[model samples]
Target chain A: MSINLTILGCHSATPRANAFPTAQYLEINNRHFLIDCGEGTQRQMRKYKVGFTKINHIFISHLHGDHFYGLIGLLSTYGILSREKELHIFGPKGIKEVTLLQLKISQSHAKYPLIFHELTSKESELIFEDDKVTVRTIPLKHRVYTNGYLFTEKEKPKKLHIDNINHYEEIDRADYNNIKAGKDIVLSTGEIVPNSELTLPPKKPLSYAFCSDTCYKPDIIPIIKNADLLYHEATFLADKTDLAKKTKHATTKEAALIAKEATVNKLIIGHYSGRYKDITLFKDEAQEIFKNTKLAEPGKVFKII
Target chain B: MSINLTILGCHSATPRANAFPTAQYLEINNRHFLIDCGEGTQRQMRKYKVGFTKINHIFISHLHGDHFYGLIGLLSTYGILSREKELHIFGPKGIKEVTLLQLKISQSHAKYPLIFHELTSKESELIFEDDKVTVRTIPLKHRVYTNGYLFTEKEKPKKLHIDNINHYEEIDRADYNNIKAGKDIVLSTGEIVPNSELTLPPKKPLSYAFCSDTCYKPDIIPIIKNADLLYHEATFLADKTDLAKKTKHATTKEAALIAKEATVNKLIIGHYSGRYKDITLFKDEAQEIFKNTKLAEPGKVFKII
Candidate 1:
């Protein structure tokens, strides 16, 4: 399985002419998800051509304006579009009340089923799961209650080795299912063909970790360990460590340190503060600790093959 | 005196990639006001270079997402910028509860005083008034309790007629204030000059009427009569008259009819439905009934001189 991520918007604080706040589209194992919808995120999704109908689940990191202000507008747009699919929202406990109040006051006709999974736990826990994928929350430390998310692809069944299966005429099409199920196939001549010899192991499952709007917390490292891809918030550089600490946001070095400690395969840093004119400095600073660090830009895509 | 209006966003239903929802920046007699803040209006304000801090009053037409979803985000941004000025908001009754709930849930640190003038009156009534300008609600017919706004510049003091005053040697600079106040000039010889002869009347007060998401209602003609400029929602063309009626929206012909009957100097038709690919059709249809008609476009400026 593969994971594709599209950064719809990634900037800290208010949205400017060129700088957008935080939002991302993650497509893992054919399932589409939206993460941390800031203001103007719907427009950004339109600009980036994110499939609107495919987004059935939305994960909000926190209730901060920069993180979840776009949720209401997006839901209203969905209503205008006459979306019939049930939508699931995962966020803080107050998300349901705030969202429903707006929808009620606005008299929105979004009659579709909106299921809210309000999160109040301060520890990592599995929040979403389906046949193809599973999502877990990584509780994060921020000025407000927040949670990161981990998405993983479920293990697939073994694949039949065509060349090895053809070696014996007794290995008929009927026996292929048994070999693919990791079972030994017995031949009519009383010989046993091991499943490992007749079938190949399935491809390794991929996982993506999303952490944003949080202070430097090493406790989350173990939960996101060895993730194929990780997106961490880096709102400032090392020079502003004091400011970062005061604001409860992470610096580039802090994000890189977390990435390095977690041993994630690749790290993507975003949520750059508007005070910084050059975003490349964030990548440069993050790369000092993690060589595979990348800067998150609007419309930028990261793929794990 | 002049009235400057910038169309920030003027579309119907939902905000699209290129088409924005209803939002306008109106500057009348040096007073700045933001009218109908749709989602992404802050970004649009930055794009069009609308002075953010100058806007102390915001008027929302209705609780529709297209009308006022961006208000929360803009208020949050103002808090981030450390704005201390008290903001006045005028909208429907439930606006206060919905807006305050979102702010509270998000823990927005906007300590600035947000005064809400809830409008539940069915008849036209003045809502906001300052020294330079006055705003009134034009009760509209829509699916929801909606009210359009009428912004009128207060009449200025009379202008001194220098050429006419030059003819009289007794008209001294010390008496200029009386002349500007439309008082007759009294010379040292006790000879009285008529106020009309000593001073010229101030420029006629300019007014703008903003109507959106409404059906064809002729009763509003008296409320918007002889407006300097009128922006009326035209969500559909003549061919889709049934749809417009069903949706409680107005067609181009209906908007033009209102402008013509109201004797407005200029008419701006906007809130075009997404089905209409050629927005020029709206202008053409509107121009058929009203000659002084313009299509509302993002960043388009309309001036009443």
Candidate 2:
């Protein structure tokens, strides 16, 4: 299964006319998951036609307005629609306070259950485990308590060539099972059916990691290494290395360094500072270290195979 | 002078697709004032080109999410824009708690000073006084402590007919004022300049009263009666009057009763429930009782002449 990522917003602290705040929609095995929810995200979802009902989990990296300002609006809307299914939100400790306060002040009694899973540690650990994927936190170096999420799709079942194997075709259930298990099948009547002739391999599971608004630390290299798709924050250009260090933000070169050291299949760098009018500098800087580098633009979609 | 009102959003409980919650842009003279802030207001402002900088004063009708969900985003954007002018906000006591906390957590300090005028009473008292207008609170009937805003534009200065004045007129400033005030004028040259010939009567100031998410209360009629434009909450249709009363929200028919009894020049009914997909029923129901009823549709402007 391949993972498709859509960038809803890719701006830093300040929201610009061209670039919005940080938010992305990741679709794996036809299931939709939201990464971050910036302000005006509902409108973005509407514009993109991403069905909100399909989204079951939202992973928030931090408490910055640019990161999760649109969360309350979305939550209240879910209540207004009288949703019955539980909405799962995974974030830091203070997230529940902010979310609960908004709901309480609105006098909104939700018809659906709201489940919150708070991440407390700065280490690699599973925050969510589901039938299709597992989400783990990757410790990130930022000004405040923050963690990036790693979504890894579960292993799919073995494939069977139904078009070739039929009930009347002498291939029994045991023979089909042997073919599905990648073994040579010998029928009861001394007929042979090779595994390669009856079945193909199941698609490989895909994984995507989101690391933003953080300094490039080598410690996360092992955790995110060989990820199918890795998005890292490149808030500044190479010339502003000093400013990046002072602000604890990553420069393009540093983000590129992480992608290179981790050997990620695809590197997408974004969360650009508004000071740089031309974002091509970040693209140029990151491309120096990583060959498959792309600048994350708002509303752009990328596929990881 | 005429008062112009634009319905930016008009839904009560929460934001819905195409039916935004309580947010409106009111304009009198050269000023623009935001009455309420529903979610996605900045996007609505951008779509309508209602310059955010021109919004000097924001009057929040209540602390409900439908009324104030977009306040922090607007304020945050103002901070990012480095607005130097002071922003005067009028709202309930919890408003400061809502805004200040978000700013604190996000570490976003505004470059401009935010002056919050907390409304904490049920009396018809003067809340905001400016050069061109004076604002008073009309205590409303709602589940929470909600108050409606009465924006009354100051009376215009009478025009003086300079060409009609005598060349040898040696009238003092007080005499000119008296003449402008419709008093008889006697010139120094033994000539009489009648007030009728010297000046025209000042036009009456136009007023717009915003009755936020509240039920029909006849007591407020004395304060908002005969307003140039009156916006009342019509959260439900005539069929759901019981639900409306139970929720402390006004039905379309109920809102029209108040508008008709108050003898308002023009009535705009809004704060619609998301249940009704079409809003024409609300206008028809209100117009059945009040002839001059109008629906507050998004991006539509209603002028008070």
Candidate 3:
């Protein structure tokens, strides 16, 4: 199990020539997902050479313009492209109304089924689950109702120990499925062979956490504990702690503190305020508390092996 | 008076890298106006160095995503920048509901007053008039209710013929105002001087007509007659005349034909369909019918001096 994340945009607030707003493309367990599509995200996707049709699910953190303004344009483009795959959108309440209204008014109706999964719960809850992965909300504190998301790969089936299986003549090729399913093999001589002896353990499952536009909240540490990778919003530096608090945004140090408390393997920080001319300051400040911190940039990718 | 028009984006349908949707910045008679703000228009304005604060009026041709998707983002950015000037948005019906609903749902209220001039008229009518310029809607035929705009500079006062005015010492400096107003000058000796003898006519007024996303409709020739410059949408070439007619778009020949029949001084064609790889084909085709035809490109400027 592995996760690959591509940062389509990472700047805060309005989009500029060189700096884009928040948007990320994540590939986990062979499932593609788009998070927080800001304006110009489609262009960024095109620039980064991301497979446009690979994405079947989209998760929006909040309704801020910097977070989700590009949604209508992308949806309309999908309609223009005549996408037939059903798209599932997980976002806060009112996303459906606002999106459908624009499409209806413009008469650019979608050719595919648009399923909206409105999230209103303030508690951590499972929002999506498939055969290979599961996604749950990491309710976050912000100026408005918001939620972070935790994506995890489901545990795979046990691998067969071919050498051990060779010792049993009763274990035919047809019994390999049972062995992989953790079932014991009953010998024809009325002897039992343990499944543990016939099968080896599967690889460990990996998890990714995405948190943004939220204040410094330690309550989320339990939910994101021991994640393989965590992307958190660091809108300000330590010097702007007061401003960060007033705006309900996290500072670099605050984000590092969350990373430390959550014990994630690596931390990716972004959603930078445009005031800072040098983004290296964010990486330097974050590294002071979390050694495994990295700064997010447009088109930058992070992978968990 | 002069008209300086900056084409922010000119491609049709969807926005792509190096190919933006329809948006233009027009500076006429000291008035700055933004027309058809598609997605990424704010970034285009920033890239082209168009003064964001100078635009008080915005004209939208229709509700298509490629025509006006960037409006809400721009309005939100204006609020973020603490814009104090009232903004006037002129578009078709349902624009207000769609825009206001987004602001309401996102809670991104504008600090400045947002006035919406909903146009439902199917006839030519004056929509905006100021001290120096007047804007009138030229009802267009399209898939949706669309209207092109005509911006004309009001007639300026006659310029004083300094050498001729000195011929009459009795015509004091105080009489200059009446002379410029095209009134006969009354000398101190009660001798009347004809206004034409004391003042020269002012520079000829300049007018610009913006027509986009419309099929060939000759009826608009009367409204846009003798325009100094005309921008018409030429989505396809003459080879795709059938497709153009079916899509309610105009071909290169059709746009040039309109420019020729309307007797406009110059013709600028844009909104090129993505199917054409070489935009020069549009210009070459248009120039075949109109000698003074120009192709609209991103950042291309057309001026009437």
Evaluate every candidate with DockQ and list the scores: 0.76, 0.30, 0.71
For model 2, residues B64-100, the per-residue Cα lDDT tens digits are 7778888888899898788999999999877887788
RMSD of each: 1.6, 4.6, 1.2
Candidate 1, residues B80-179: lDDT per residue as tens digits? 8888999999999999998898889888857898889998999999988889999999999999999999999998999988999999987789989988
lDDT of 2 at B193: 64
Query: Which residue pairs come into collision in candidate 3?
Result: none
Per-residue CA lDDT of model 3 for B1-305, tens digit only, reads 79999999999975567788999999999999999999889988989999999999999999999999889899999988999999999999999999998888778899899999999999999999989999999998999999999999999999999999897767777887888888987767888888888888899989999998899999999999999999999999999999999989999999999999999999999999989899999999999999999989999999878
- lDDT top scorer: 3
DockQ of 1: 0.76
Evaluate model 2: give its TM-score.
0.84
Q: Which 10 residues in a row give candidate 1 chain A its minimum summed lDDT?
A: A170-179
lDDT of model 3 at position B151: 96
Top-down lDDT ranking: 3, 1, 2
Task: Put down candidate 1 lDDT per residue, A1-305, tens digits, no spaces.
Answer: 88999999899876688988899999999999999999888988888888899999999999999899889999998998899999999999999999998999888957999999999999899999998899999999998999999999999899989999898987788877777779998878889888889888899999999999899999999999999999999999999999999999999999999999999999999999889999899999999999999999999999987
Error of 1 at B258 (Å): 1.0
Q: Alpha-carbon interface RMSD of model 2? A: 2.6
Which is the winner by TM-score between candidate 1 and candidate 3?
3
**lDDT (Cα, tens digit) per residue for candidate 2, span A247-277:** 8899999998999999998899999998999
